[model samples]
Target: MTTHLSVRAPDRDVLSDPGYQAYLVLRVVFSVAPVVFGLDKFTGLLADWPSYLAPWINDLVPGTAQQAMYAVGVVEIVAGIVVAVAPRFGGLLVAAWLAGIIVNLLTIPDFYDVALRDAGLLAGAVALSRLAVRYRSVQRERGSVA
Candidate 1:
């Protein structure tokens, strides 16, 4: 005779809502990505990012494109930190940053795909903002229920 038993608990699916999972994943991604890319701007360990800057934006900045990228790096780092602490507002900041990136990529020749990708990322950040609000409300309700 053999005994059959369930090793997995059915109650463990508490956080299994796909939308909630996606929102959580986006939170982590948006949190870490900007920080990593921003830090890379200073190190150039990834690439000399200034080379990707549009000539038009370069013209507007007083110093070198590298200097402007350094400034961008600082903003990106702050955005990541803000997202980590408060995604509701930070998501909009990231969306704005992505919009700026999209515009910049548009100015460069032969980078339409990258611009398109940034646009998608911008949309995701916006979605993340909405999702964060909803998730917080649900969490509050759950807390009250408990």
Candidate 2:
């Protein structure tokens, strides 16, 4: 009897699989959540937010919390849009920004919960970045430039 040999290769269509769909959902949620929070900065939906900054942020900015909030709102909205649409560079930007937020949250003892929440979000950002890169690479390999 002749010897038999088998070689296994990766599934090329993995990017189009249901797992990728889940990734898309998670990415969209992560992107949109920031937009909502960013808008709230302008609207002051969280009654405690301004007061929470009454001690430190005010001293740092000096009569400029509202202006600073507006700037942050604009940036967050733009970043959210980028993540939802562009994905590639957007993911990188989101991940970097989230890292900064996480770092800041860690400095405040009362914000430990927020810090933990951001840690989870940071993981999601990383996952989205990987998914975007993987999908792009797969498309390129398959000769379908997207």
| Global Cα RMSD, each model | 9.0, 10.0
Q: TM-scores across all candidates?
A: 0.86, 0.73
Stretches off by above 4 angstroms in model 2 are: 1-16, 51-58, 140-146
Off by over 4 Å in 1: 1-14, 144-146
Residue pairs in clash, model 2: none
Best-fitting candidate, measured by TM-score? 1
How do the residues 104-138 of candidate 1 rate in per-residue lDDT, one tens digit apiece?
Answer: 99989998998999999999999988898887767
In order, candidate lDDTs are 0.86, 0.72
Q: Which 10 successive residues of model 1 have the least lDDT summed? A: 5-14
How much lDDT does candidate 1 score? 0.86
Q: How high is the lDDT of residue 54 in model 2?
A: 35
Q: For model 2, what is the C-alpha lDDT against the true structure? A: 0.72
Give the per-residue Cα lDDT of candidate 1 at 107: 89
